[model samples]
Target: MVEKPGDSPHLLVVDDDERIRALLQKFLARNDFLVTTARDADHARRILSGLDFDLIVLDVMLPGDDGITLCGELRAHQTTPILLLTARAGTEDRISGLEAGADDYLPKPFEPKELLLRINSILRRMPAAEPGAGVPKVLHMGPLRYDIARGEMWRGAELVRLTATESQLLQIFSDQPGAPVSRADLVARLGRSGGQAQERAVDVQITRLRRKLEDDPKQPRYLQTVRGAGYMLAPD
Candidate 1:
């Protein structure tokens, strides 16, 4: 059985073909995803500017600026996983998409179940929090309230959508509030092999987490980096 993350995973489907886009959105929704649609690259950019998605399903052939270019551009700033959709089934084409920062790729006229499996596979590779006890049920960070038990965050009454990785990071920090956790230690605890590459990946995940948790990511208050140490969660 496929493991469903705590909340419904949010997905953005970008395609120029109206019928394909609508069909994918409905089909993915039926599989327990919170689906959002974009007409093309420009529309996807517009929506992405304001909203955060767990994963993006982008069509390679678009009206303008294709998926490969968009995927490359997005990877520059965001670490959100992207899965490319293309009609071309050539091995080189699939390699190009992966080189452009897509986590996975699928050819046109494929089974929806295959796509679902790919998404789940990508998510299963992300870091997860280790089970522990004595952590507070609710942690206060300015106006944001994180419920550790439920694996949920809220800003006043509005629930914040967190990707699986982000949720795991938060849980890890909450487990040891006010204590520093070294990057290497974080890698070990999150079930990732210790290495420079994995450490850098942890940094990227931290940056993304800050965007959600901090009012100013550049000058973070809650999640702080100790100069020679590591990161500490200072919740009020």
Candidate 2:
């Protein structure tokens, strides 16, 4: 049996298929993960409220809200790595999945070994938790102040309530002040599963983040978009 990590890599498996869910949970647990199973997105959401997961395995097809929509919603607040599983193999379908904020996708009936490999790849590629460990780490942008280590955002002395995903996204940009982060790069860096659609969602979050931090959301100076490049958070 694979020994679990000290703070074991917590994985949430969201699938309606009992067979697949059970198999994945057992397989992943044997391979050293601390696995949690959810019958669907609703169940997963409940679990998400209480537990901090390192990664999420979500099925593309569900009874309601579909995996892609749920993934987009999750990305709006959290930067947890997501891997999408689908029975459809169409290029558009795959691209659509990526666009929804999935870090990676696997078609159904895949090899267990391949799934293991992909999971390992995502975990390995996850960004370092602390990019600026020793430097003056408080980020001051306009009226907002963010403590990257605590994953907390504040306006003056008042704490701003940010969803788990928002905090992670802010944590990424705050790490590199004034750096232009590409949409594609953000998708990759954040380990989102969807492709183009996911990038669009990122834009939405940036808009929301800007409104919260900027004096005027329409004319943003701190969070500027680079023409044909991506978004950058420049804090003074």
Candidate 3:
């Protein structure tokens, strides 16, 4: 995304409907965000090419590339948080959206105030680099090194880009290294109200984190599932 000069947290709102797009733009702007609106996936892609946004509000039903398709595409290279809007509220659909790498999803006909709350929550979870006060504490797993204080990972000299959710998950795991943290606990730590969907969302975030941190995500080495206990970190 292109760089714009502003202190406000910028947001990209993507939807096919002009009315919804305009309404979200106005509402988000009123909430003190720098809002950019896109009619569909192509328009959103064009805008993203030049400007960087703090978060994306995407609609699952788009004309060309659907929101799930676009979310997966963008998540591959960028860690900007995405909150999807969809009419379908099925468990499978929500799981698919999370598996595709969306940060969160909202069923349509939702209150604007609720949408605002989700947006703000996602933005709040974003990790920021701090000025190092001393040598930062690090945890290692094979070739990767994670700075515990800053919530950053590095493979040799190159830094790994982590989504906000992944960073927060890592931070939580590092807090109680060898101890298993339950899915319910993870959901609570993530600022999500406890629900089956939220628990599934936690699992998806764990899988994504494992792909980045483990030599084999299918048979994880560092991040391990603890049977009925939950998940834990086994740092070497």
- What Cα-based lDDT does every candidate model obtain? 0.81, 0.78, 0.89
lDDT of 3: 0.89
**Can you write out model 1's per-residue Cα lDDT over 120-219, one digit (the tens) per residue?**
8667645444467777479999999998877778999987866555676788898899999999988776665577856776777687778888999999
CA lDDT, candidate 3, residue 127: 74
- The numbered model that scores best in lDDT is 3
Reference-based lDDT, residue 15, model 3: 94
Q: lDDT tens digits, residues 24-46, model 3?
A: 88887777888888989999999
Which 10-residue window in model 3 sums to the lowest lDDT?
1-10
Q: Estimate TM-scores for all models.
A: 0.54, 0.62, 0.95
Candidate 1, which ten residues in sequence have the lowest lDDT sum? Answer: 121-130
Candidate achieving higher lDDT, 2 or 3: 3
Clashes of each: 0, 17, 6
Selected candidate, larger TM-score, 2 vs 3 = 3
Q: List the residue pairs that clash in candidate 3.
A: 1-50, 1-51, 1-52, 2-50, 2-51, 2-52
Q: Model 1, 32: alpha-carbon shift in Å?
A: 0.9
